[model samples]
Target: MKRVLCLTLALLSFIPAVLRAQEPAAPQEGLNTVMQKASYIIGRQFGADIKSNLPNVDVKALLEGINEAIEGKPSQLTEEQIQATRVELQKVMIAEQMKMAEADKKKGLDFLAENAKKPNVKTTKSGLQYIVEKEGTGAMPKETDDVVCHYKGELIDGTVFDSSYERGEPARFPVNGVIQGWQEALQLMKQGAKWKLFIPSELAYGERGNPAIPPNSVLVFDIELLEVLPPAANK
Candidate 1:
């Protein structure tokens, strides 16, 4: 909430510059000057950010507040009142996010329960589940070893968030450098093994999901373990 206010202040600074340039402000007349057009573009960008973050904001109230602040007029709201309002709004937003995260966590647990019923799916004691698509004869990787693999990752809803195959290149990382689910599975998998992995939110990102993934989202990954090699220091 405070950051949004800061952004609002920064964007409004453009208005004074346009006023200094003697740019006319008449929406009915449309953008006729370069300064006006540029300011409109900046406003549109700010509008996009606000829409994505605070969809329920009152546009009229927002504009009025901005105008008051810019015109050096006394605001209907005192600074203390605005700060208190922001604190309350932040709490509401946090509560809403928690509800969404809990819902996602429940969906993931249900998916894992059904997935474990499949004949090929094996559930570990720690709750990791996977299906071995192809067996490998090579040795498995150690925690410190870096493994090269091709993998495609998706959410439970089949939203593909990442894929090494799409980039036409394999990815390499330490066995223990990944999420808990990947770390555990990689240690049990051998070079040349192909597996379909079902990772619950707890073993995946939990409530702090990646930018590409939603909070508490269950993950699905199709991985081909290509090679396992010691870390650079080992060589």
Candidate 2:
């Protein structure tokens, strides 16, 4: 997930401090030593999650590969053999991911079909569905306009993927620069309007979804349009 990757990157950024701490110094004065020890503890916590995702991974072989690479030593496998293995593994991963995506796509389609029948839900020609929660008397945003809004996004399964509300901040971006569903819906909405948007995968992330969202997943969003600003403001 995106959050996991972000946390990992944040933790990895501390490696420099850890390295610097390895310098000879009095025990009490050694921040780097303290950091290195802390990193190992944190790494084990993160490593457990990584290992869960890679259940079939050979831990010993992986450590050996890392150690050999770091020591500038030849690997037990030849370059050609390694390349072949990597290519094979890539194919396997892709195949498995696609199989999961197909299942998700079916579930998304079924959910959308039933959701469209609900009262007040309007389906657009692009297969985007939305329910206007509040009407605004203010002007509508143009395609090139930048807008400020608060939004909560989730998958069809009701798994929260992202939210500006949770962060206690509103997000601002170009109306045309977002996903197709948001683009269409924003253009139709006036400033101060609130809507519950149901976006099919095609109008959302499609087949290759981002780290937080799975492939072909339908996305739901609760959005409140706060302000429509000039496009130049963002630039």
List the candidates' TM-scores in order.
0.81, 0.70
The residue pairs in collision within model 2 are: 21-32
State the lDDT of candidate 2 residue by residue for 1-235, as single tens digits: 3445666787678767666766565556433466546756666855676575555678888678757976999879988998999789778877878999999999999999999999899999999999999997798999999999999999977899999999999998888889999999999999999999999999999999998999999999999999999767767
TM-score, candidate number 1: 0.81
Off by over 4 Å in 2: 1-50, 57-80, 230-235
Query: How many clashing residue pairs, candidate 2?
Result: 1
- In terms of TM-score, the best-performing candidate is 1
Q: Pick the candidate with the highest lDDT.
A: 1
State the lDDT of candidate 1 residue by residue for 84-165, as single tens digits. Answer: 9989998999998899889989999999999999999999998999999999788799999999999999998899999999
| lDDT, residue 205, model 2 | 95
